[model samples]
Target chain A: MRKTKNSVSYNKWGYIFLIPFMTAFIIFQFIPLLNTIYNSFFENYLVGLNQVGPTFIGLDNYKSLISNGDLLIYTRNTLILWVMCFVPQIILSLTLAAWFSDASLKLKGTRFFKTVIYLPNLIMASAFSMLFFTLFSERGPINSILIQLGILSKPFVFFSSTIATRTLIAFMNCMMWFGNTTILLMAGMMGIDGSLFEAAQVDGATSTQVFFKVTLPLLRPILLYVMITSLIGGLQLFDVPQILTNGTGDPMRNTMTLIMFLNNHLYSKNYGMAGALSVMLFIITCILSLIIFKASGHDKRK
Target chain B: MENKKTKGMSVHARRTFSYIILVLVTILCLFWFYVLFINATRSNGELQSGFTFIPSTHLLENWKNLRAGTLPILSGLKNSLIISCSCVLFSVYFSTMTAYAIHAYDFKLKKFIYPFILAIMMIPTQVTALGFVKLVDAVSIFRDSPVPLIATTIAAPVTFFYMKQYMESTLPLSLIEAARIDGSNEFRTFNSIVLPLMKPAIAVQAIFTFVNNWNNYFVPALVLKSDDKQTLPILIARLRSADFLKFDMGQVYVMIAFSIFPVVIIYLFLSKYIVSGVALGAVKE
Candidate 1:
């Protein structure tokens, strides 16, 4: 009887503690998600409270989105930015983590290096936007230095060119985040048993051989984890482009990311169109994540 | 003797190469700080030069002007602190409670819930942003108010993920079971025994959440309409694009300094936990 009562009370307490999170999730996350899917089929307007209803429009929103030229361009730009940024990001992070882990280097001031590298990640996007703007603007330091070094005859308009703008965004993303990825990878490296390294060393393996044969293989799981998370994050890229490009997606809307396009639809009060885009983005993100999980061998365990 | 000598030479050369790489990385790290710091201090004229490493005396004046801007730098600082602190508090309390429940108890829904959380981790924030905005506007909470809670609360997902991961690994269920056997009720057991063990995890989550919230721009830009409620990031962005290149450059530096100071200070003090906490979260189970 006592055991029964105790278990009953424990269950009640558990439910009570869980109520807040569940409530927030249902109201905020789950319900909104359902509404978004539903709204994607309607023509929505920002009507007053008396007429706060959506007009049914079926698949028109999705059809329009598919045929939109700007949408196609945004999608292409986003992919380019992600690839340019993410490839170098993963490589640099792995390289740095490997270098830092080398026992022979015994590099002094590892903490200082780590802290400084991670500092940019802590700064708000606005400050970073401002800082980058000051650096890359036509009269900004980058152009000035290039011209002064006789590398360029004149100041090049960075934001005015699609390639330059996209490259700059990719560069900023890589610069700010490689530190975080490195830290994550390093942690993964540390978890590898010390015995493995010692055994490789005893077998007359060079450090390079030990890293390739032992470390890289061991770090694969964590590397996959990092890649998936970065992929999700890269898809959500918005702040830099929005702020740096002055929110118009200027220089011919060349840097208009998916999120920015979604934002534009929202601002125009085109709820149906925005919701359709949101669903499309969601489906694409989910499918890509699923593919990555499968490719990374996470699916086999389940 | 010849083989040994050659082996020694190769090792030495490798060591030298590694040292060179380390130096190069260290310089790279310093270069970012130098760029931001130098630009922040330069006059508009000198800023056009791009690579000036010399310090200028305009920092103080820039700071004063920054404070006097339309948004008032201090107000941005205040909003940032309030949002970050409140979000941290909410995340820490609820995350601890949820983690405790998940870890300490075996219940009917446990299996379904655990994997659900992991699956949701893959859903990018962009996919949810539009839906969240509509939901928030639909709710009456921010009906007439300028600030929307949705923008601030979207941070809950990452916080929950970190806390759940930490709790599963660091916490031992036996401890909670022991507390129950001692006649402590569930909340009491959690408040006393479990909460103390969670401090390290809490500290880690707190710093990450704080930094993320403090630097947040995109969500708030969408949700917030009033200038007074605008956080530092929005303020900086607004100031940067303002037609007046005439606005005090000194103030802009001051604003940058203000935006960076709190996180830097916290990071300096708790640097050790930051690395360990993230490592624990990102590495596979």
Candidate 2:
């Protein structure tokens, strides 16, 4: 009874400790989230330095978003960019992880390789975008080098071609992230029991077979985590494309992403539209996350 | 014996192949930063002329030009430092406190709070951005101030989750009970005893939080209106988009290098921890 009372006395400290975080979340994140939903139902925009009505206009903003069809185009673009980057990122990371984690290989300088690759991930994305922008500019070093090497007769306009622009964005994203993915997947690979591989080897299995039959199966959870997080991150792809395309999403807006579209509304102070777009984005993220979870059989495992 | 020798030769060949590929990848990763720094040292006219392997002597000229240019590069640097440092402080300290609360105490809301925070972790910032900006502007005090940016950091779910995970593994309640028995108050014990034990987790999280906040542009672009208040990423973006008449590729490179310089320095010092911290996060999950 005395111990129970003593424990009860300490309970208040938990609530007290939580107050600051809870208060900030409620004010800065939670309430704003609800406000975004609420604002979606009202008409609010700026008209040439004039504040327009936050007047009630139920479903209109969402209606226009649907009717206009840009959402579909942007969503497709976002997904395409994500797939472009994610596929290469996963493959390269997997390959690197395999090489680094292979004990028989006894690869030298694995630590150096890991550190060098992750350096890109440390730099600011916006700054990295600027570096790319300058390097791939019409008369930039990349073009000049290629021309000097007789690969191209003239400087190619990278920002002008849709394929080149999209590829560059995807490539940059892949470059920035493959190292991180490599590290995560490497850690996952390392955690598998050594005996599992030894057992496979003794059973007349090749390395490839052991990887497929034993290694990959045990790596499902980490793979699932990487994919879902990458998917969510893919949905938030903004800084690279934003800075790369100069917020134009040019080359016929092929590089335009979902967050870029939302940013346009936010930029214009079109609260209703921005709010509506944010709601759609929120829903899409939820549905996609759920679909991924379901597809992975995560629930069954749990 | 002959067959085994051939197999050994093949294995050696494959290992050599892997080393070559890794070296190539390492070059691919480091080449851009080299190019960036090399370009930073060239004159604008030299830049327009063509690419070169060797850097030129125009680095000081470019630096002088960047300082003289309309962009508030130094102020932006200062703002970024202040903002990122403040964010690191708030995020690491408060998240540790919240994690400690959840870890140590057996309150009624213990089960609920843990999952609730985990659920909240998935809610991306872009979803809350529109309303955040609106709410900020509506509340006059928060408008055009870093308060919202700094305040919002207190609820960093990722950091909190990691801290809670760390505490669960390393922090023992018996330690806290012993401290209480020694007449140490909860706050005092947390400050002196708990914080010391959490240094590794704290250091790792602090570096990440600092780098993240320093590089953050989206929310800061919306929040800070004044030139002096802008962070480095924002300034770098503006520098890139500046009109052709005033455009200097050399200065642009210099400014970007300036922005990334600090982060690279910090990273060089703490990369081991950062890499391990990332792996730790994944393994814990």
Candidate 3:
């Protein structure tokens, strides 16, 4: 009788503990996600001053997105940007992590380096974007330095062209976030047994040899995690581009990201198109995430 | 012994090379700050003249100009504090409760719920932006109020994920069982026995949740449209695009610095927690 009573009490307590989170989750995340998917099929109208009502429109929204040439450009740009950002970020983060993990370096101030490097990640995205704006503008610091050093005779408009703008943005993003990847890799490095390094040392391993063979191999899972997540995050890149371009995706809309395009539709009162774009971005992000996950063998590990 | 000496010299050379690389990275890390610092000290015209490494005397003047702006930066700071603190509180409260439930229970639905939270972690907030806005609009929570609970910095996914993961890993069921055997009620057991032991997790989650909320821009931007209700990021954006460039640039930097300052301070204090917190949240079984 007492055991039964205890079990019954346990279930009751479970419900109580779950009530707040479950309520918030349903209200905040789950319902909104479902509504977004549902709204993608409807034509939303602002009938009165503020009332938003949806008229069912089937797959017209998705059809419109496919037809819109700008959408295609946005998708292409997003793809290019992700590649530019993710690839270098992974390589540099791996290199930095491996370097830091070196026993011979006897790296003092690990904590200081970690904190300083992650500093950019902590700064508000808007702030970082603004900082970059000041640093990379036509008359900004970068151009001035290049000009003074005679690398260029005049101030080069960093954001003047499409490719230059995107490349600059990608480079800045890599700089800002490589620290985070480094930290994760560092954590993974810590988990590896030290005796393996000793064995490598005994085997007449050079620094490069130990790094390429031991460190890189051991850190593959962590690298994979960082790469996959960065890919996912990079695909959703909105704030930096949005703020940097002053919300227009300027320079002939060259840097317009997929999320920015979706946002544009939303602000333009085209909820259906926005929804469709969202779903497309979602699928792309998911596919990329899955590819990285599979390639990293995260699935096999589990 | 002679071979050992050569090996020692090679190690020394390697260390010197590594130190050079470290110094290079450290300088690169400080490069952005150096640029910002130089700009902050320069006059507007001087700033446009390209990146001079020299510091100017306009620092105090620019700060004074920033202070005298119409936007209440101090109030935005206060709002950020209130919002971030509340978010931490709510996240901790709910996450601990949910964690306790998942940790202690073996109900028919336990298996379903545990993985559900983990799966949701993979869903980025951008996917749910449109739906979240509509939900907030429907609720009309922020319609009449200056501080909208539904729209203003309240709803977050990563917080829930972090809390749930923390609870599962840290809150052992044995302690709860002991408390229950001693005739402690469920709430009492959680409050006295469980919550105390979960301090480390709480601290970790609190710092992360606070930082995320404090830096959050997109959702708050979509939901809270009122100028007064605007958070720091939105305010910064407004200042960025505002007319009166001469009057606004200094104020913009000040506001930018203002928004970044608190997070920087908090990060300094809680830098250690970030690694563990991220690990717990990101990697899962």
Candidate 4:
């Protein structure tokens, strides 16, 4: 009788507590999601003083986005920039994680190193981009230094060159995030059992071989998590490039990303195209997340 | 004897290599910040002329100019603080409460809510941002108000997931049973007992949520249209594109520096918690 009463009271309390979160989730997130998909099917925009149709146009937004080829170009730009950053970021992170987590190394001042490295991650992306903009401008310190060092006869304009601009963006992103990636990877590394490394040593395996054979495979789950989150973040890469290029995505629009493309539509009050692009982004994120999961060979049952 | 000597030398060599790499990477991470601060002190003319590692005397003048400029920077700071703090409070408290509900009670929707949260975590906010803005605009109260920004974060799925993971390991049910036997009501027990017990998790989530909310530029930029309502980031962007001001680079640097100064201070104090908190989040997943 007591147990029955306790269970009943607890269940009542449970629902009462969940009410706030559920209300917000449904009203804010879930409803908005459905609304986005609904909006994608309708044409909505503004022309000077006139408001255009919220007219039902079945699949027309998607059709126009694909046919215009801007969608594909922006997607390519986003992916390329992501790859450029992720490759170096993962490599640097793995190396650092290896060194820091190695119990045998017993390296000193790691706390200091970790603290310093993670500082960039704390700064706002907009502020970081602004700093970069000042530092890399034609008459900025970097160009001035290059001239002084005789690396260039004159100041090299960073923004005008597509390669220089993209590289700077990639470099800035890698710096901001590699610390975070290192910390995550280190957590994965430290979780691995020590006996495996001991056994590898007993078999006369070098550190390199042991890392390849034991650590890499065991670290797969964390790596998969990192890759997917990074991919998602990369897809939403907006503020860095947005501020760096002053919302232009200039020098032949090579630096323009998917989010920037979406922002352009939203800026012009073209809700239909914005909705379509958002849906495309959603679908792309789901598909790519699945692909990375599959490629990582993770078992769901685990 | 020869083999022992060689092995010792190799170990020393490896340590040296590690230090070199770590120091070089550290320099890479912090070099730009050094330049930013250094330039913040120099005049626009001095800045354009050359780079200097040494500090200059123009910080106060730049600050004065920045204050005198059209940007409402002080207001931006206050707005950012209010929005981020409120959002952090709502996000952590409600997320904890929701997680507690799932962990402690044998409710009907127990299984459903957990997976539902995990699924929502996969959906990025940008994907739903258009609809969110439209809905906010449609509702008179929410339109142009920061309520939607602070309130929507109450359904923070990632924080919920983390709290659930924490509760599983740290929060035992026997304690709740004991509280029940003591004739304590549910809300009282949660407020007095569970909250104190969950401090470490709460602290970690609070910092992450605060920083994320503070650094957020997208939704706030889109939602807050008025100059006074805008946050520091939007103001900085305005200051950046303020072409009519003769593009005062010194003032620009000062503004950017000021924008990040509080975050840098917070980071300096809580970096250990922040770094370890990150690792903890990743490992539990």
Question: Which numbered prediction scores highest in DockQ against the true structure?
Answer: 2
Runs in model 3 lying further than 4 Å from the true structure: A45-53, A296-302, B1-6, B45-51, B70-72, B144-157, B164-170, B243-248, B275-285
Better of 3 and 4 by DockQ: 4
lDDT of 3 by residue, B197-234 (tens): 88887888788777777877777778767656667887
- Report, in order, each candidate's fnat: 0.57, 0.77, 0.55, 0.77
Worst 10 residues of 3 chain A by lDDT: A44-53
| TM-score per candidate, chains pooled | 0.92, 0.98, 0.91, 0.97
Worst 10 residues of 4 chain A by lDDT: A293-302
lDDT of 2 at A127: 94
- Which is better, 3 or 4, measured by lDDT? 4
lDDT of 4 by residue, B193-214 (tens): 9989999999999988988888
DockQ for each model? 0.55, 0.82, 0.56, 0.80
Could you list the chain B TM-scores for each candidate? 0.88, 0.96, 0.84, 0.96
Error of 1 at A193 (Å): 3.5
lDDT (10s digit) by residue, model 1, range B137-207 = 87776642333443335326566777777777778777877887888888888888888888888888888
C-alpha-based local distance difference test score of model 2? 0.90
RMSD values for the candidates in order, in angstroms, are 3.1, 1.5, 3.1, 1.7
Going through the candidates in order, what is the number of backbone clashes in each? 4, 0, 0, 0
Ranking by DockQ: 2, 4, 3, 1
Candidate 3 C-alpha lDDT tens digits along A1-302: 99887787688777777777777777777887888889899977454466465778899888977997888898888878888987887777777777677777787887787777777787788877877776777666788889889999987777668888898778778877888888777778867899999999999898788888888777777777777777788878887888788777778988999888877777776677777777777777778777876766654664
